[model samples]
Target: MIHTTPHYHRIACLCTEAVETLYLLGAEELVAGISGFTVYPPEARQQKPKISGFSSGKLEKILAVEPDLVVGYSSLQSDILKEVAEAGVDILHFNHHSVDGVLRMVRVLGSLTGRRHAAELLCEQLEGQISAARLESAARDAAGLPRPLVYFEEWHDPIISGIGWVGELIALAGGRDAFAELAGHARAKQRIVADPQTVIDRQPDLMVGSWCGKRFRPETVLERDGWQDVPAVRNAERGHIIEIKSADILAPGPTLITRGLPQLQALIRQWHEDRAG
Candidate 1:
């Protein structure tokens, strides 16, 4: 008898982005629990037990699920992993950056869950989508249009530009990032644009703010005296208020290209039309 190894029965996803990726990778059946912050797929919240959130959560609830494997990401989840592993639960941790990293993660997750073929297929699709966006950007450039200067706000408290994959995605979207120097650094400390006048000096043509999980208030931006000098504000251009959930962009997964890149393309196209007029 050729014994095919049995697939893992119950899996817990502590990271919201991984939950979405796993669902797309044909491992939905194995998902026994998911993070409370998972909002992309409504089904996850509806069906899976709320075991984890952005930071800390009910470890006992995660333990109660009795997951054969628990997935985690970033340093934020390190403590949770230590507890879970000490308790004798299996875990598959992933932390990656750049577009290539995301593909690797999909493949790894697929292998761990016995869905290698599904992972390969998904990776191919994601790469193709990214290629399409790049081609679109090139086409826009060929038409003798200039790219807009972009400032992407990941946080507002100390004023930080995006870090890691988000910064990379901004470049791929055909816009020049005002804070590209801050890419690949830790999220909190990176791109501390402490001087509001520095933003005024840069004179960004477009300002895209995700503001993490909260709604990006354009009026708050407009209200600032230093910001009034920038073109995006004076024209009331309504600088694109992007609501990209942080988990997806920061995950270093296929969704960065799948979800993040396309949104960037759309914004670039909008900029092109605005500039032409």
Candidate 2:
């Protein structure tokens, strides 16, 4: 348990990650408000007033709550921060794009909320999980078993690769990302796959799609012209297309560490086992 927590008690968070982590670390008592998208800890919806959204917010609503600190993340929520700053409301914005970034973010949030010990414990647990996963995956790789080539689709129409954290998790899960370069990008736009043919050329052994919370339709992928030759598409009837829920793997928070990484590892391990047999 966090014995030494931060002093700022009236916290207003503009995203699910902050609220969920704060709540998880037993700092919920400090939260006076939360983002509209917060669905985890289901009771959070009942407890805190919602005041923000992607690229928009009711700054006055947030201000009315009398928050001492407004915690949020990403460039997407910057506009809201600017408005809050102008209104003289203190705000802290996190822009983490990698796996380590998420841990550091949680640590920082824990410290901010006076849950430093809890945050460090959580980070240590996450690092332990990561290390165990990497060691197991590395052992399998050393055995000369082919690591399945994975293509993670974050979007469909224009075809965007997964983010840095997702790419890092994919590697830890014993798969090679087909679009590793694009996955390095912190922004989604920068990860866009300009030519659809590039994906086709990579010929991924696994095609996982999570359309940023939108329902992913694997059938839509198979229907694409010229994608038939792609290994994942050619095996579509055999159900090669993997669907990870956005909440499971996309959120850059505790869920990603505790749930997302494990799920990805299971999928990749299953693929290897199937091929080995």
Candidate 3:
């Protein structure tokens, strides 16, 4: 008989992705606490004690939970994790910036929690989703469908480009990332577009805004100066400006493949049909 018991009995997840992954792995019962920002498994938000936010956490509250282990993500949580470590609690921090990295995270987390088999099955499911998306994109390409150049905005104020995983998923979903070169940068600051005019210069066929959990206003893109001539802006009236919720795309988890990628593929497919029409 295969052992499905998790090693960690009480885990505190300081990120939404970890919380979502735990739920997907059927390890939610092991989670003692979760980040206040966790919303994917709505039940998590309701049931789990909120222990931390992205960059801030009350160490005392975290300690109060008496977690056997703490899981967090990104350098943004380094300081918080460090504090937790100083308190003599074991912690694991993951900094995955691409699709492959995200997958690796799932596998590692599963192994650490003693749910290796479950994790492998989950990865296979996710990989299958990705393969299906790639095949769909290839079919479209073979049918002479033009892949739209997509400008994905992660932030509106500084005009940040999508991260590595987002760019890779865009390609899998039948669109070319307009800022693919910038997506490789690990830091969000490094992905910042220096000038708004650069976007106009790229002339992307579609503009997608996630805004890192903030509401994406398509009107904001349409109102940019000298953007009237840009293809994406000109086509704004025809649904070229899209908004994907950050929870679906920004979180480095299964949702990227399950929810985010499908949305991108559908949008790109619509773009192709609209252009062909």
- Model 2 TM-score on a 0 to 1 scale: 0.95
Considering TM-score, where higher is better, how would the candidates rank from best to worst? 3, 2, 1
Residue-wise lDDT of candidate 1 within 179-210, one digit each (tens)? Answer: 88876676567578888888889998777777
Better of 1 and 2 by TM-score: 2
lDDT of 2 by residue, 1-277 (tens): 5266476879998888888899888988898988887867789999988887756788888898899888878898888888888988788998888888888888888878778888888888989999999998999978988888989999997888999889889999888988998887888889999999899888999888999869999988888889999988887666578888887788788888788889888878777766767
Model 3's number of clashes is 0
Clashing pairs in 1: none
- Pairs that collide, model 2: 5-114, 6-113, 6-114
What is candidate 3's lDDT per residue for 11-99, written digit by digit as tens? 99999999999888888888999998887899988898998888888889898889989999889999888999999999999998889
Off by over 4 Å in 1: 1-7, 142-144, 238-252
* Model 3 local distance difference test score: 0.90
Position 266, candidate 3: lDDT: 84
Comparing 2 and 3 on lDDT, the stronger one: 3
**TM-score per candidate, chains pooled:** 0.91, 0.95, 0.97
Stretches of candidate 3 exceeding 4 Å from the true structure: none
State the weakest 10-residue window (summed lDDT) of model 3: 1-10
